[model samples]
Target: MKKIKLYRPIENFNKNCSYEILVNGKKMTDLKNGEEKVIGISNELGKLNLRAKIQWCGSEKLLISESNNIEVIKVTGNKFLNRQMPFAGGLFPLTGIVIFSGNSELFKNIGIGILILLLLGLIGTLTIWKSRWLKVIRE
Candidate 1:
């Protein structure tokens, strides 16, 4: 038997949640932030496929070959379109609430708009671009 390590590092956006690790399209384990899980592989197993899924979002299917024999896989929540814009933008409305306490109405309206946009992004990720939500790479 051989061991494959699955590691999930603490990330800024999605660190609070745990993800389901899939081995050959089956739920193998739940990985949490900064946690590592050792998966056992049979010697007779020819090819191994690993993926991470949380709700409808997931990583690209990864195939492990006997030639490379990778033992460690790093997993994390991928940024939207690999950009940091949404993360920074998401904080602006929250900042406004504290900054403009006298004008709560204005900030409330702005927050609603931002929330809607964020919801749309979540919907897109859950449906159209589900595979891009998680990043899984061999280490």
Candidate 2:
């Protein structure tokens, strides 16, 4: 599997337009108008570019004609990286509350919500406690 970055140079691409990508003189499949990805392999080292219409934003995966032969390289934009959340010290408490408040009876007539809540609460508490104790011992 190889990673290749693709750039679109067209202005205002319509979602209904077809795009083409070629690799190593082999004509690749025409990308669907709403397609976000088209997989292709590179035999020579050059500008591996793609011509496609801009589809809707925020879609994660794209289907390519040569999906088996091509691997789509993920371009890590700032917007993508910024979505990661920092390790919160509140995970246990928040999860505990959620489990305790959620409808566990929905799982069955048996009241499993309390059990799940307790389990999550225990896990969260243990995690927080371990972290705090580790810090104290380190200090």
Candidate 3:
């Protein structure tokens, strides 16, 4: 059998908590923050399903090459879209309303419409977040 060396470089965002490593749905080892370990596996010529998850958040998965090709596996924090987008969206319409505040009644009506649209945008943002549309970049 051969051994595979997987290097997990820790970052500040992920260094606070230990990561649970899983191989093919089986718990393998617990990796401490900033710790590098050489993970050994069967030398069989097949793909390996590797997963790593922090304590509080979701898991990130990777597919190891069937052959001995990769030498280093860098693990980093999972990036998510900013949660402040909803607030920003809501504020944008309010800003427009403030700018359009005038003596004309029609202007006030239009502002109300914009406010409704802002609420819709906020709802959409919440939906997007709940659906896990955020993309994870693997280093």
- Scored against the true structure, residue 79 in model 2 reaches a CA lDDT of 26
lDDT of model 3 at position 108: 76
Q: Write the residue-wise lDDT of candidate 3 on 23-49 in tens digits.
A: 776777777767777777776636677
From the highest lDDT down, the ranking of the candidates is 1, 3, 2
Put down candidate 2 lDDT per residue, 42-123, tens digits, no spaces.
Answer: 4344543432212221122333343334444332212211222123333546655555665774533333555565566556
lDDT of 3 at 6: 46
Clashes (candidate 2): 0
Q: What lDDT score goes with residue 68 in model 2?
A: 34
Clashes of each: 0, 0, 0
The weakest ten consecutive residues by lDDT in model 1 span 80-89
Runs in model 1 with CA error above 4 Å? 67-70, 81-124
RMSD of 3: 5.8
Better of 1 and 2 by lDDT: 1
Report the backbone clash tally of model 1: 0
Error of 2 at 6 (Å): 5.3
Find the 10 residues in a row with the least total lDDT in model 3: 129-138
TM, every model: 0.65, 0.24, 0.51
Candidate 2: regions farther than 4 A off:
5-13, 38-139
Question: How do the residues 22-49 of candidate 1 rate in per-residue lDDT, one tens digit apiece?
Answer: 8788888999888988887775766778
RMSD of 2: 17.5
